[model samples]
Target: MSIPFGHQQLHNRYCFEGKLELVTALRISSGRASDETDAPFIRAFDGAPYIPGSSLRGAIRSEVERVLASMGKEVGLISCTLFEKDACAEKARKFLQKIETEKVKKDAGSNKQKNELTAEFAKLELCDVCKLLGSTVYASRLVIEDALPVDVAIARNHIRIRDGVGIDRDTGSAKDGAKFDYEVIDPINSSITFLFKMTAENVTDDSDRKLINLILGLLKHGLHVGGKRTGGLGKIKLKETDNAFYKVSGFENSTSLWKAIVNGEKIHNSIEWQEVIKC
Candidate 1:
């Protein structure tokens, strides 16, 4: 992943590694049913329910957008929800066209210089949220790994059933033949904990760093994932103890960062590497 700004190669890596406890039942579905049930929870190939990285990324992106839409508006942190027609990116393209036209007229700058200028302008056009969580125009700054139960045996035993019925709005009654049941894990209360790890690249900007800290704060305070959020399922929080954010900076090139990434080394807690920072 790049720094959510441009497609430049990443030279640095920062990792947030920890355990996340399931405070409530989770019911993210596989969208297919087994012979014994109308719905089933999503599971890894090992037959244990695992939360996909894509799902976690989507949820965090939504939360980041929500925060940016509220806190970033005053500072020009635009939120473009439009698909491919995001206005800011479009405007940037148009502006780049003008710059290209002017450059051609002046016969100024080498091809490399022109390309660098275009990239800078494009980067400037991105909003803070787009710069942090990413949009259609750019790749995200970080990646999350799929969350799996630390103790698979415990997870296997936690599957539970929940019955749901569709209601008719007009009659305020249960719709005929609309009752269904689905599978959930550790529905009421849970002792289930999953591994949580996120890796971000080339986050040097203060605003980008602050956004990263804010995301951690949100996770620390807790956030709900999976389905049935309105019904209070999928409430998860970072385990405060032993959680760590590693700012593995001071590297000179991508080679060292790649080595650090592969090793998954946990550095000591110091003035630099704090455990969990407030937003």
Candidate 2:
């Protein structure tokens, strides 16, 4: 099948390695518990506090959507409930249908055909967010790894309980039996790191890259994560330590991609890709 998107004809994948510092206590609650603390932070298999990739992805996507909306651009995939009423949603649905129809015709009982269909789907003409983060019709080009604490021992020391109470509107005071406690990651003593990867297939344009960079810029400005934002929780600052951008069309081996990242060469200055910070 032919590519239905714009000028781009090859895949361009970019990888970002970064660290997240908690400026304030972050409380990504795992929900209520029977223990002393009513809420607790989410933990990994090893019983250590961790930030899920999905959480980060959702946060970034939401912020980018807001930015796009401010520019009078509708990039987010809207819900079906609003499809008929929203112009953006209608456009997205039509685009998805076109890809789905073509994919069905090209679908054969072979891995090659499946891969080709996936590639074609990724190249569809859709909103920037849907193109990068994906929607129902396309697979996500962006992959975010779980952010693990750099030092587990140090991370443990940062965990603390914060007490809270609900207030009665009429009395303007704490409501009776409304006291609660939740666990939080204290920023005073800890920091975490994570990895980000983006695969831009058949990208002949710079709009998506510019948008991704804008999202990263927003992330650096302290994006709130988790819950209780009104109560001053989950404020974080993300810093990118290393990044690599590659044109993967003519590569002889896939292992070279990892090698480029490992080499740590500063290639963010290139015009072909967006400029990313090194520190």
Candidate 3:
């Protein structure tokens, strides 16, 4: 099948041509809002109540759009046929329409006029990618992508992928980490020109290809979190003093990449990072 339009072409000849990176740093604490049914109806739905996958996918795509925009390229909402005739899309359409209508009614102060609105029509439409990929890559703790350098390397058996890094939220210690939790990264199709922003520094390197590569290398390898747990409730500890340094690292790359693109130029990678000292 021919590649679709309004989407960045994946698997290109140049690293910077079709390849780019965007890192996102999530404010984990900000995610704890409850009683969101009182929030704007557009914001509340009956999905997992966890972070929405579409929100993350939208984030990645938005970053890609920003990078393309900087290059004087124009792209728009990547409308997908994946949702056109499918049951999920139809369901999503009906669901959104109902909620939007209800929102209007609620805003008009329509109280207690009970209509036969089923609970099924209020769920959020998750990103189809998550269903296709079979895990929550969209809502995972982190997502990082690197445009592969043009020269492809050949190796026997499976090539070793690099480890990404994470920092302890409590103590100011840096630890090697995976870009995502298990069942998340496994099904990603590298042939596609999309990757999750791993750490914040990757989005705007100061044209320091070497430094960027060095940092990516350090991150590409798995960083360890000192704990013995599995799944979403994993644990780690760092001294309080160093917390801010790592927090900065998380934002240096993803959404901030667009901020750097102000005045029609990409921001230089000039931020200084210092290792956090343990208390």
Candidate 4:
């Protein structure tokens, strides 16, 4: 594929064009109350329900982190939590101190300074998750756009309300005055189509390629995007309608490449990157 202007050195870019089909009711709550409902699905300004990009990105990142952890990779830096902040901070501080020590030793004409610097550089390097999703240190190479309904008018028919009640832990029964209702997308009699796009840039390293493949696999398999997972809400399957991998530095016309991607043609390989990676 061809690279656009101002991106002369662009290595590889992958575009994920897909639709999410709800297999079960989906509830991505807006956290707002209305006269007719206690909970409602998030909606656009025109009242058309949609999924936020940040929500999808967070879900994908979490799944990738879990997969990395299972493979025994060093995900400590990438999956650092609020409770681990102090420990991570101290660990980072020690890394800096070690580099400073190596610098001091080099000033004294030590021969092992180069090896120490190399080791420290490897240690301080960002993990694959941070490199793709972004960290406090650098920008992300992946971009996920908000998923909007392919047909807004048709989507309205899938919207419905579900009732529930909180259960008391002590009594193992329904709590008094705990009944609630929420809106969800009903997939029993209707199917809602969503358009999603994911753009990945600078995918030169083998590790990054592997990570992306893992994420795409997870997406294709299925995911619970919204709330009420315990109640079996938000069951979705993503189907890729179009995809393109651009590797060349430049081309005569950038518009044609985009047009080809949208038409799901002019690609050399299938959208399945998992076949290329070991995982």
Candidate 5:
């Protein structure tokens, strides 16, 4: 593994690839009403249902935070809630701001040197989650691609609409004229598999690397994605053999890298990290 210093570089790349099954009906809303339903599942340009990388990343980050919040103190680590603007993140934010402000005054011979300075500072300052997933200072090493249904026909066949309403807490009844129906992938019949792949660069720290593995383990047990968790939607899980990790190298030194032709590039390491790594 290579370290990320003074500036970030593509010294090493790791991709955690896997197949995930929908354990329950899923409703990832497109945020707008469709002609057929009040809330429709988001789709690609070709109309095939897809999970956006950002959405998946958000869910992964959220779960990781929850797990850490529950068990992190036991391990002598603290996972800060970035959403709550917690002190852990506040400290890192301030450090980044100070560095950014002072960068103009320093010699910072080149862009690489400036990045190196910032990256080094972040390595020592950022929390475990923010270090891997990004924060006010460091960019996230994790990159998740859109997860698509392995069998598009199956996904299409099992999608159905379910009725929903806004509850009037005061009266303990449904609000008048608030009735609506939203789309969902039928849980019983839609046991469709989705391909998920994410790549990261320079995750050399032992703790930081384990955080990535923790996410895979969490997904295997079960996790929710998209919207409607209260209604029991968006349940997904992984199989025993689904979590595959590949550490790819040689791209930086290879001339054919940019052409997407790294046939002979060194595959530094390969692993089924989920089986051996612990949170």
Candidate 6:
């Protein structure tokens, strides 16, 4: 007898690899006061700040969910395929029934069966109904680790909203000239670190190019990040021997991707495909 086997082993191997990272942008307003509720109710900091790990994870999951929905695969599944092979087992049986009815010699019988079966098949063939489910299921497999700040920006032109008003009328004018910063640390290897020092926005070609140049600068100067904890803040150091890859930008703004292409720069907004350098 011939053996019939599936690719379960190969699937298992491919399933365990990590493939994505999500970053959430964080903002802390300066020149403002608290509401006793501990909520940051001040205009102290300017513009939206760096994103935290938790926020990044939430955003990632949300984005993944959105992508899944857009692709028609938003089903909630706990393991493996979003739908079990058995989910449509009964549908298969129904399909067979329709086929058999089509073979009937009576035109009325065939017509009746065809109409009824068409309606039933519509339910099964709908990708929209089941795609979201599949997407949710697939997204669940995504391993989300704690968010580490990659970069933060305090926009120069950004206005602080105080008591629901713009900066001009507010006590503080976001003009303290905001500072942008991000964290890149070695999760696996502590010895290697890279500090992606990003400056406040300046007049540049495109937002993407500005970001790319900033990142490239960070990488270029990142070699000096180990054993040099000046402020005790965590930082990552890029090394000569590292395999790093920029991921696609997943921000609400899709136009930023053009910066990289237009300038032949390596600035990426997407964090999913980024390859962390091994220390």
Per-prediction TM-score: 0.73, 0.66, 0.21, 0.67, 0.80, 0.23
Best by TM-score: 5
lDDT of each: 0.70, 0.60, 0.28, 0.66, 0.72, 0.30
Flag regions of model 5 displaced more than 4 Å.
5-7, 83-88, 103-113, 167-174, 241-275
Candidate 3 C-alpha lDDT tens digits along 1-279:
221211122211112112221122111112232342111111123211122334433444333333323431222112223435644456556655765687787774232322213211221243322221112211221233332222222111111222234556777577555242211111122321122233321221121222223323323321111111223221111112233212232224324545545645444443444332111
Evaluate model 2: give its lDDT: 0.60
TM-score of 4: 0.67
lDDT tens per residue, model 1, 1-279: 334445466665576677888888888888998876778989999898888888887777777777766776554445665455756667666776787788889988687766566557657777666666664435677778999988888877898878878677899999998877888888354578888878777764556666677678778777888888778888888776634422333343466656656787533221243333323
Model 2: residues >4 Å from true position, as ranges?
A: 1-10, 32-34, 72-84, 87-125, 166-176, 189-204, 240-273, 276-279
Give candidate 4 regions above 4 Å deviation: 1-10, 72-124, 166-175, 240-275
Which candidate has the top score in lDDT?
Answer: 5
Candidate 3: worst 10 consecutive residues by lDDT?
Answer: 5-14
Clashes of 3: 24
**Candidate 1 vs candidate 4, TM-score winner:** 1
In the range 142-221, model 6's lDDT, one tens digit per residue, is 22233223332312222122222224336566435443232222233212211222221111122223223333334334
Specify the poorest-scoring 10-residue window by lDDT in model 5: 245-254
Ranking by TM-score: 5, 1, 4, 2, 6, 3
Residue-level lDDT tens digits of model 2 in 1-279: 232453233334455555676777777877658476778888887878887877878777777776665552343232122233644346656755765676688764365654555456445444666666766655666667777777776776788888878678899999999887888888784464433333344333455546666666776787877777657777767664555222222221235445556787442322244444222
Worst 10 residues of 2 by lDDT: 244-253
The TM-score between candidate 3 and the true structure equals 0.21
Residue 237 error, candidate 1, Å:
0.2
- Model 3, residue 186: C-alpha shift (Å): 17
Q: Give candidate 4's whole-model lDDT.
A: 0.66
For model 4 the local lDDT of residue 10 reads 52
